[model samples]
Target: MPIKTTKKVTNKKVVKEETKPAVEAKKEEVKTAEVKKATKPAVEIKKEEVKPAETKKAPAKKATTKKAAKPAVEAKKEEVKPAEVKKAPAKKATTKKAAKPAVEAKKEEVKPAEKKKATAKKTTKKATTKTTTTKKVTTKKMTKEEQYAKLSLDTCLDLAKAMSMNVTRDSIIQQLILNPDVKSVSKDLVNKYQLTGKFNFEEDGYDEGLVEVLVSKVYETADIKPQKAEDLQADVDHALNYKFTDVVADGEEYKAQFDTMRKVLMIAQHKDIHDSKNLDEEIGIDVEKFVEEFMDLAYSVLKTWKYEDVDYYEHFIYAVLSQLEDLHDTYRNRIMMDVADLYILHGDYGLGDADYGYILRENQIKDYIYYRYASIYEGVDKDKAKQIANQALQFVDDRFTYYPNIIAVLEG
Candidate 1:
């Protein structure tokens, strides 16, 4: 009985807590009741907290609580009514406090419900988004290899043809290369090996294995350069700058030619003061030595090279002619020009024209030669001088129309 009364008093603290003296009185009453129960009834005792003063306001709160306690029913009712909706912090706080009794056991119990709520909320959000929004799912475009394959087949065929490859066979190979696994098998197959020079294939009647035979020839003609066209382009650049790679024999010989020619021009210009002003004072002595070294290196560099390529031969010949002219070796250059002319007449037309043009434009062979011959024959052989001048005119172009004036200078 005392235990029940103490519990009831503790519970009753809600309302009576407003009046401090009343709460103290209630506590004293609970103590007396416990004493009475202990003393009078060792047998049995029952106590009712039926005091109207104590129970009246408490029941109203209890009635309110019973309505609030059935949260499911109350939520349903609120849903139906829709008018009693209100924010209630005190309700939330009380609910949180009441939940503390079994918080440990209930925490686990509440987990699945919270998870279900979360899942449902997520589902609803996704469904709403699906209805209200439009989105595009994009994938990456083709990678480089894929793009290369995706190019038009016609474009591939044209590219192969321009590169002097057999179109059908190369196209098959290129198409096979669409598969990376297969592409690895042919990494070294379609290499860029150049087949230079002119050769008659009409009598050969389209040799089926010409490409292979030509590649073999390149190895023989140009040394087995295995680094693809990368090295070939570099070779061209070096040649343009009058240079050769160290791989060539006597690779510095062209430097010597230039060095001799450079000194000839310098010495010819400053001959009156050569005793005092040195070549070093004019262009530093080291420049002449450096060019000499280059020529020494280039001496036999062209030995292995055949004059088979028309353009390469022409450029080589022109460089020699220019160097010779720089050294005032016009007579020696005439012999070189005759050598080039003989080679061109053998079949190469391009080199022929280049040699002819060099002589005609420089007025070396036409003006100087005719003048030299005419001066030697002047008065002593007037008929011979006129005949030589007329012969010179036949070879000269209108660009060198001053040949007659050159002849008149010789005559004077």
Candidate 2:
């Protein structure tokens, strides 16, 4: 009975030992509950924080699944659509069917173009093979004026200007031909411009219409010479002024204007005296009497005739005066002296001023006029002649100062 009781006790102790740990666990749970009760607000706050974390992870997991599915869905859909198939392929097909005629028309159009391309390629191949036909060479011939009209004067002159040869119009024309700008045409135009008898070398000699076109580009675009600038400028001026117009006008105003200038110029000059008139006789030379008589005719013309009606008064005036001053004959002197006397008598010193303008135009004229005047007065007024001859020196060009005529006049 005692051993059974002891065995029962041992079994109870083993069972009790396990039960005691369980009891301690129950006690820990009770204490943990009390502790949790004391920290319940903190536990609730941490649970709230963990809830947002869990919520964020929930959406992330859901989003990852949807992202994977979306790609799979889009890829599967794309596999059926192709690039342009989803775009109204029926309308596109109809448009393509409608464009068939245009395509056929384009193909028809391209046929001739392809033929031309093939022909051009064949020509190119032929050209490369060192076989030039005579027909190709002969097709490009041109006339002289036609060829000349094509080239700028600079292009024509480039060859001559390169060689530093004479660059005259004639010289340029001659050289440009040798460059063989299409051979014969260049040669003929050059010969025509340079070798013609009818072509004038002076300003008025140029074609008035041609002058208008060439003058603006004389130096820059054309091959004209520096010495020819003045000549060309004069031509353009003449073309712009008197020469372009017809000389016919009311009452022969043109002729009258030109004639009157010459008449007045002749009337203004001092007369040359003869040997008999030089001596102290009744017929003795009196330049004052000569001046008085000539001034009468000059005044008559100034009152009766016109001087300003001419188109080229400037040109005419100078030319007239130049002619009168060149007069060395006694008859010319007598006629001109009578005209001079008339001008002073009429109180129209305008003609004298015009004469002075002509003298002042060129140094040559100024010197010549003075020399002529002093020659007439040499015996009558030696002191005055010496003064007049000295005055002539001032009018002579610097280069011509030591000229033989100047030295002889100085000594005389």
| Best TM-score among the predictions, by candidate number | 1
**Top of the candidates by lDDT:** 1
**Tens-digit lDDT track of model 1 for 1-412:** 7976664543332212111222233454434333222222212112223343443333222113223222321222222211222322222332333322222212332343455567667979999887665432232344444434444545544444554665354333322222212333233234432423322334432222243332332223332112232323343234335644455433344544433433333342334222212433543333234333433343344433444432333333334333334322433444445444444434444564465556666665466544554454454556655765677766654566557665574355
Worst 10 residues of 2 by lDDT: 71-80
Off by over 4 Å in 2: 1-135, 158-194, 197-368, 371-412
Off by over 4 Å in 1: 1-248, 251-300, 306-349, 364-412
Per-prediction TM-score to the true structure, in the order listed? 0.26, 0.18
Per-residue CA lDDT of model 2 for 190-244, tens digit only, reads 3545433433324322222232122222334433222222223333232223321
